[model samples]
Target: MAADMAREVKLWNDKREREMYDNFADLFAIIRTMEKLEKAYVRDVISSKDYEPECTKLIAQFKTLTTSLKDTVPSVERFMETYKMDCPAAVNRLLVSGIPATVEHRASSSDVGTAAAVAECVQHFITSMDSLKLNMLAVDQLYPALSDLLSALNRVPQLPPDFEGKVKGREWISRLRNMGASEELTEQQARQLLFDLDSSYNAFINSLPKSA
Candidate 1:
C-alpha cells in the first residue's frame, strides 16, 4: 500500500492542499521547538505527556511532504531548463532593445533630473505591478503548482528559552522606564490601566487577522 501510494503521486497534484499541509508542518515544528525550549527555562511549561503522540503525527505528515517534494521539484526544474519557459525571449525583449533601453539610457545624469527620475520610477513601479498582477493571474489559471517543491525550504529558527523574554521584554521595559512618568504609579492604578490596555489591545489584535 505504501509503495502504491508513492507511485500514484503526480506532478500535477493539488498544490493548494499540499501548501496547507506544509503550513501545518511548519507551525507544528515551531510549536514543538518553542514548547521544548520554554520548558527548559520555566520547567513544566507543558505538563501534557501526549506531546509525544503529536510529534509522531507531525513526522508522518512531514514524510509525505518530503516524498512529494522529491518527486516534483526536479521535474519542475527540468521543465524550466528544457524550454526556458520561465524567462521567455519576449519578456527579455521588454528590456533587450526597446522602451526599456530608452528608460535605461535616460538614467544618465545629464539626461534626467531628480523630478524626472521620480516620475520615471513611478511609471516603472506601475508597470511592474501591472505585469506582476497579470503574471499571477496567468499562473493561477495554469494549476497553482508552486507548492510541494518549496514545501520546507525556509525554516524559521525557534527561540531559545533564555533569549525569549529576556532580550525583547527587557528592552521594551527599559524603553518604558526611560519614558519617565510624572510619578510612580500605584499598584492598583497600574493594574487597572494595564488591564484596560490589555483588553483594548487584545480586541485590536483579534480584529487584525480577519480584517488585515
Candidate 2:
C-alpha cells in the first residue's frame, strides 16, 4: 500500500511538472506573438487603436502567467534535482528557466523535440528583435531573452545541416551586439537597424526546411 501511494504521488508530480513545462512553452509563444503583432503595428500593417488594446491585453496575460510560474519554481527545481533526467524535455525546461544543466544537454538528430525547442527559442528572439525600438532601455530589456536563447542554442550538439543554416547564431550574436551599442541612434540609424534585423530574421525563417 505504501509503495502504491508513492507511485501515485510520483505520477501526480510528473503530471504537474509536464503542465508547468507546457505553461512555460505557452508563455514563450505568447511573447513571440505579441512581438510579431507589435512589428505589424509599427510597420503600419495594423492600426494603432487595434494594436494598443490587443498588446495591452497580452502584456497583462504575460504578467499573470509569469507570476504563476515564479511561484511554482521551487517545486520545479526540486523535481529537476531529484529526477536528474538528462532527456531533451528536461533540457528544454532547463534552458527556458535559465537553469544550467550538465554539459551533456545536447541535441542530436535523434533529439528532434529538443532541437525544435531550441530552434523555436532562436526564432522567437529574432522575431522579438524586430519590434525593439533601438533605444538603450529597449535594448537592455532584450539582453536577458537573448542570453536565454543563446544558452539554449549552445546546448544543441548537432543540428541537421539544413536546419543549422537557417538559425545562424553568429549573425544573431552580431546583430545583438550592434543593437547594444549605447549611443543614441539617429532616425536613419534606427530605420537601418530595423531593416537589418527584419531582413536577417526573415531570411533565416525562409531558409527553414518544410516539415515532413
C-alpha local distance difference test of each model: 0.33, 0.48
1-212: candidate 2 lDDT, tens digit per residue: 88877764332357768777677666656555665765676588987546544553454344335545666654544544554533333334333432112112344556565545545444444434533442322444444545555555455444443444335545545555777544344567456555654564455445445430
**lDDT (10s digit) by residue, model 1, range 63-154:** 33332445444342353355444433222322232122223345665534432332232232222222222232222221111121111111
Q: What are the per-model C-alpha RMSD values against the true structure?
A: 24.3, 17.1
Query: What's the TM-score of every candidate structure?
Result: 0.20, 0.34
Best by TM-score: 2
Candidate 2 ranges with C-alpha deviation above 4 Å: 1-109, 117-119, 130-139, 146-185
Instruction: State, as a TM-score between 0 and 1, how close model 1 is to the true structure.
Output: 0.20
Error of 1 at 104 (Å): 1.6
Q: What lDDT score goes with residue 2 in model 2?
A: 81
